[model samples]
Target: MTNLKLTRFAPTPSGFLHLGNVYSFIVTYHLSKKHQAKILLRIDDLDRERVKNRYIEDIFDTLNFLELPYDLGPKNLKDFKSSFSQSERMGQYAKALEILRQSKLLFACDCSRKKVEKMHPKGYYTGFCRNRKLPFDQNETSWRLKADMHQDISFKDLNEGHIVGKLPGILTDFIVRKKDGLPAYQLTSVVDDLYFGVDLVVRGKDLFGSTLAQVFLSEHLGPNAFAQNTFYHHYLLQDPNNQKLSKSAGATSIQFMRKSGKKKEDIYMMIGEWLGVKERIKSLEEFGRYV
Candidate 1:
């Protein structure tokens, strides 16, 4: 494999950082070092309703406490707010949206969650709005890409080599710009990755569908570098009930664990046990060996 130039830990400050977040960070750190790539700490703070100042502070606090370092991005909350926040890149997102609009590949929809659930049992968008001809500037309307399910989407995978697949049903015609006038996650993520020159992406396997969605979006944005980037989707850390850990599960958050007197080593040990690593992991270096 060719040496990658950069990778990133793109965390959203919607809630406190959890053990699962740290596991993905460790994997990114390991791969960055392995490929001699610089790490960029990209904080996704676009969801204004869920984003809180305390949650943003927790990101910097957790990284400092764990001694995880990044070569690029804001050094603290103040720096992030001043420059690195996703809001700072609204213009770039707008440009990409315009490109899609000009390509005639975007449609405006004003469907509510309840209405969508009623349309299909699985709640998958039935492309009801594809021919609705809703105005792009209409209030309470979101812009969605008109997806071609039969089209093959291909991208490089760090572990399994080049892989190809069709866009998943759940992500069919995924929203690019939300009703609230902000670019959605799928749109912002591709723009940011391309903007920051991130050639290596590390995320959880749960996001494999998202990866495909972003790759498909990249193709529509004209010739771009996002599709060429390599991805690594690591296994998730689940609770005893085999449920995926979420920020809403406060007890599993690093902040909660820290308050409970769990040191960084304790957190690492817990993750090691969950990962089924035979060797005890007491530090980032030890954990690196296993990842």
Candidate 2:
């Protein structure tokens, strides 16, 4: 069957695929199945230091146990695309850098983490390197994309409906590459989606704020950079204590559930109940029908 929609279950195999991951995964699976979409499982093993074999295995194991079939990926480091890791996509990031440079939006600075911590700014990016193009040296220096003053990009979110926020100084001067010769998440993610021709993104609301960063970068991207081709569906996130679950929070671990001999039904049911669709998910086939 030629599935009209294309969705991905991209996860970073850095740590155990936890309850938060499962909730998002199953929701994306439901959306994909509803649209008869081709689901690709891309491993976001960007953090090389943390990406391990066991974690990767657990990702597949969890999906397999839940009967969530994927058409591509779940690939290991060796079986992946040459530059599978986001850190390895330097060339692609460099190309993006050149584009931002041509637009006179590229700048450099040698601000340390300590400096930023001492005087934390409202935005994650402190705008230290927004215009301080001192020099590009391997020994030190980071680059940021110049964000225009009081700029804002408005869009309608599928789930959240209308979202109008000021990205003014927030997005001004973001990083495309890091000092360790690694690409930042925003730059790499945008580049990958554009290059891979991803048409739809079904993810948890956790990534909603991330969409803001992507939208800003998209404004400066070239025509047909694949920026305008995608659609996003940010579903409800799983919150254990009216707060987002974290690794430190014992309830967040899926490994803990598995060890406790939790069945597929247990996990699926929890997801359905939380989404308030428990009555609809009578069976695996019933998921798409109801959603």
* Strongest candidate by TM-score: 1
| Model 2 Cα lDDT, one tens digit per residue, 18-108 | 7667766666777777567777777776666777877777776777776777776635445554545554566777888789878877777
For each of the candidates, give the backbone clash count.
Answer: 0, 2
lDDT by residue (8-109, candidate 1, tens digit) is 999999999999999999999998988999999999999989999999999999999999888999999999999999989999999999999999999999
The TM-score measured for candidate 1 stands at: 0.98
CA-lDDT, candidates in order: 0.93, 0.65
How does model 1 fare in lDDT? 0.93
Q: Which sections of candidate 1 miss by over 4 Å?
A: none
Could you say which candidate leads in lDDT? 1
Query: Candidate 2's error at 120, in angstroms?
Result: 4.0
